[model samples]
Target: MAKNNSRNMSDQSSMNGYIKSICDIMRRDNTKGAMEYIPELTWMMFLRILDEKEEDEHLQSEAVGEIFEPSLKYPYRWRDWGSPEGKKRKELQEGHMDDFLNFVNDDLIPHLKSFEEKTNATKRQKIISQIFRNLTHTRLGSEKNLLDVLDKVDHLTSENIDDTHQFPLSQIYEGLLLKMGEKNNDGGQFFTPREVIRAMIRAVKPDVKHNGEYATFYDPGCGTGGFLAENYTYLTTPEISDLKLNASDYNHLKHDGFWGLDNSFTAFPIALANLVLHGIDQPHIGLKNTLSGRETYMDLFEGAPYKFDYIFTNPPFGGKEGDDSKANFAFKTGNTQILFIQHIIDHLAEDGTCAMVIDEGVLFRTNENAFLQTKRKLLDECNLWCILSLPQNVFVNAGAGVKTNLLFFTKGETTEKVWYYDMSDFKVLKKNPLTINKFDDFLMRLHSDKEEDKISEKSWYVDIDTIKKKDYDIKAVNPNIKEKEIPKPDELIKIIEESQVKINESLQKLKELT
Candidate 1:
């Protein structure tokens, strides 16, 4: 999808202002927190976008002399309940506001919820039913506020500006997710920064056309489907256009190429809405704790290790998988990261590639049997190709202080050599966040031969013999940067004396005051 329209700051601000107005309505209505506002806003946006798309498709069908079978009945359609010219809006303005809200509460939602019961429902209908099933209109205050919010939503067009390349609904949706994570109370646990998602996608380079089969990507711990969405864009971009894919190829790719799982009750709908707004008519995101094993989607994975062609994710950290989930893995670890690592290895296709972020503890913790066994299996079964020690500030907004590394590897090849890139010194702040350009040199080096790939003092490689002797610890230690020497006791005393005079002067001044 080539974007011929270019969006300037003014267009973005106008749309953002609209979003801000919606949030203001929610806040005024006492919608409680970001948790409430996010879901509320997402569902509203989903309906609005869906209606616009349906109308366009219906017109096209009519133009081609085909009957447009609408997914919703006339009374349940967005134009019926959501548009300004609709009966509901006219009644809402004329003091039948409660009647309109009652219809939405008692009638509209129930109709939407019935999609799951239809034996012949399409994937899109099922997805709609799943989202509404998990959703509730909690703490939405008053009908007046709802009408006000609906009016603001009605102002949004599918495409903002036609000539100047204004932001589309997709960008608006992405921005809202970012806002939910950044300014809302959610702490964005389900949202990985876009920069990190793109980097992981670039590293894995998943291609449906090149694979000669129905290529797929999975994120076992998909928080709001960031990795999966980024991967979808990668496969459809013009850079991969040389494959000469037609419309049906893309249609297949959009519906089947992505799979995601998450345990969050809150994240499921958000992820579904995110994917739907991004033109994935039927997203394959399911609700499951990647490690929980509590519920199953036998239809999708066939009750076995459903291997995907590529696996890319940033699994939740600073938590532990419970005993029941731990029982499912060979390593038998309570650690969440380790269990996800094992799960990915088991479910990755024979030639599958995976790029994930892991806590630094997984790289150096040799005390636990589970950890050691994980490292052993990773080394023996896969070629662990690269490690990038990321700067801590990269995840500071997520409250992550533990040093993390990006691990890229493929199955069915024993490790021979591993490239290490030390980016600890790379400064990143919230205001000056990491960007795709920052990883340009690293990505270039990633594809080149070892001899030609050297970038600076931060890049190096460790052979398999060295790794084996070190017991498979893959932490990057830059050989090029010389270590600093510690001072002797006498030198330490001299350093203390240098600061003692100022300390004594301050103490004496305090004594005089006393």
Candidate 2:
């Protein structure tokens, strides 16, 4: 066990070093920020990882007596272009900078994009085309910097995956995501905090015991595939649980039980890279705008009216869908959040479960027909069981100050009563964000039939009738807590100063006694 721990630490250290090297190269290259650096960095990393996976796949196939079709020919593979001996690297070292750059932009990208036309192409191959279709050479305009980045990425290999000296590539990729998500632009849309993802996964419990072999998970607006990656991790990792299952169930889930969709051209590749690091060799994340129409991505939903057993996502909010996109939904709304909720209702299977992070406006906004109708359908068709009112700072890092709630529900049952857990009092901020440990009190109350203790002061339930009387308003109001008394800024400052003085006096007296 000690030896294993040592090896893991070594692996972690090595991986972190590689990531630091890449970031250093990015900085030296004058890449703008994570928004510019990550995508360009990811494009190179994707090819390198894909090449390694292909090698592993080929070896496994040979052992199993199966044929492994190669995606890229001799010079096109990462081993050919990315390694030290590779032509691109050699050319860059020899001062043939234009030659190397032109080959990548002119030959390499076009070749990758041509995979869509390959006859009998594997699904992975098709995805390669989909991923590289819009990919442009964003960074790495400098040949020497590009070579430096490639050299760093080339050090990442499966053999070093768990070595104590190396950081796992997945950790590095997620780190880039964290950086990219700090952008206040559209790039920030791809990040939902991993803690939030884990909380939702724990609440929904998407696993084989509940869903069985047909167990499947889908994310309609899967930003950078965080939920899907975490969901896969949750199902595969063994723990004491209520679910009855075996190794095969876990295996099935690891390989074939997840799908994600996002329309953003930029986000799709990052999502693919994220899932790839999670050991999903061929993730079924579609790149279509989910709101474009119900008929969109028919290939993904064959039986179609409702296909997913578990749906989890944080849909893009505060934006209106175009009229062309709105025409597809029954609840004709320009509101992106409403349309996504409607889409979830449409694609969700009978007995399917969903845990989504929705804008706070979704709870009580009934002014528009689209908002009211969507909420009405949600209550009428699903067992809208829980609304976890998150703190405002939950998304502060992602540049969103708009409040959000985690809505957990099952599809087959009608809403009777809704459980509301108000976490607003947690006082979380970007630096001291809410962690999964903080969710234990709420989860315990949810799992047990026992009502919230008056002392706990942050949970309560409301009947469906009461909700209907109030138009399904789901804001969490902890009846046990007394209304807060507002204090002026000056008064609050005086109170803080008084408290500090008392604390200092107590400390001074204790010191004198000692």
Candidate 3:
């Protein structure tokens, strides 16, 4: 155990050092800060790993006496252009300084971006195309810096980082995502805290292939694919739970289980790379404006089922849709969260489950038709089992100050009552971020079968009739928390008179001293 611990420490330290070295190179070469460097690094890391994965696949296929079709041919592959010792790399190194930069800017990027336009593109091809869809040119300003970044990424291959030093490659980007999520980074749309994602997945415990059909997990707004990646990790990691699996189940999970959609052109590629780094190969992430009916590249989502079995997402809050987006939903309004609620309802299969983070205002603001009608539709169509009133300012790290709540519900059953769990009193600050351990009490009572057993000062049930009377105000209002009463006018006058008499006594004492 001691030896293993030492190896783990060494692996973590080495990986961090390597990543920081790459970041330093990026910082000096026009890319500054997390927001700028992460995107440039994302493509490099993804290609490095992609080449390794495909090479392994190629060897395995060859050994099994089967033909394999590689994604990129010849000079386009990372080995030809990016590898430190390869032929093209040698030519670039010995040739004019401008040669390498020109090749990348002129040849490499355009070739990669042209994958989507193929006559009959493969899934990988479509993915590659979408990943590079927005990159019209290279971000690295010089050949030396680009080559350095390439060499650093190449060093992180599976061959270099053996079993003893095998840190998850996904973690390298996760930290960068946090920095990008900071205030003014404009990358919060792709981040929800990992702790929050884990807590939600733990609560949901979404199953896979329960009755022969493969289960599907979806996210409408898959920011850096945190929920999907975490879901995969939770299901696959043995220490978390004992989920017995067959070969078919595992294969299905890798190929068909995960699906997502993102409108942000920036988030779309990052989400793809994030899921790929998490070991999900066929991540069906469609790059489309999910609310506005705008299509970017949805070829990967061609055969997706109309309704999914499970959804875990953190949709962007404070979003307002235009007429084009609002026209599709029955509740016609600009509020994005409400439109998302309606979209989620329409896209859930019978008995499907969804646990999502939503802005708190959507719950209490009943004056808007979209807000009230959306809440009513949710209760009428689904069993809203839990509404966890998360701590206020929970999303401050993401540059958001709005109060949030976790809405967990299953479709095909009308909500008779909702179990509200209040964690609002727990103050969260930037230094002391929220963690999974903070949810111990809530998780302990979450599984209680009896309604009476579930009732506590922090949690209780509110029936449908009360919710209806309040115009579908489904916010978590704790009945146990008593509001402070206001003093009447006469009582206020009496208190003021008593205080004035005391003041007079003090003045008399002062006058005597004078």
Runs of candidate 3 with Cα error greater than 4 angstroms are: 1-14, 159-167, 397-400, 450-453, 485-514
TM-score of each: 0.90, 0.84, 0.90
Between prediction 2 and prediction 3, the one with superior lDDT is 3
Q: What is candidate 3's lDDT per residue for 94-155, written digit by digit as tens?
A: 89868988988899889888888897778887788777877877788887788888877767
Residues 102-153, model 2: lDDT tens digits:
7788888888878777777766766677667667554677877776777667
What is model 1's C-alpha RMSD? 3.9
lDDT of each: 0.76, 0.75, 0.83
Candidate 1 Cα misplacement greater than 4 A, ranges: 1-13, 92-97, 159-167, 239-244, 296-305, 397-400, 502-514
Q: lDDT score, residue 7, model 3?
A: 27
Q: How many angstroms is residue 464 displaced in model 1 relative to the true structure, after the best TM-score fit?
A: 1.4
lDDT of 1 by residue, 261-316 (tens): 88777788788888887777767877777787765332333333378888998877
The candidate maximizing lDDT is 3
Considering only N, C-alpha and C atoms within 3 Å, which residue pairs clash in candidate 1?
5-165, 6-165, 7-165
Q: Order the numbered candidates by lDDT, best leading.
A: 3, 1, 2
Q: What is the lDDT of residue 373 in candidate 2?
A: 80
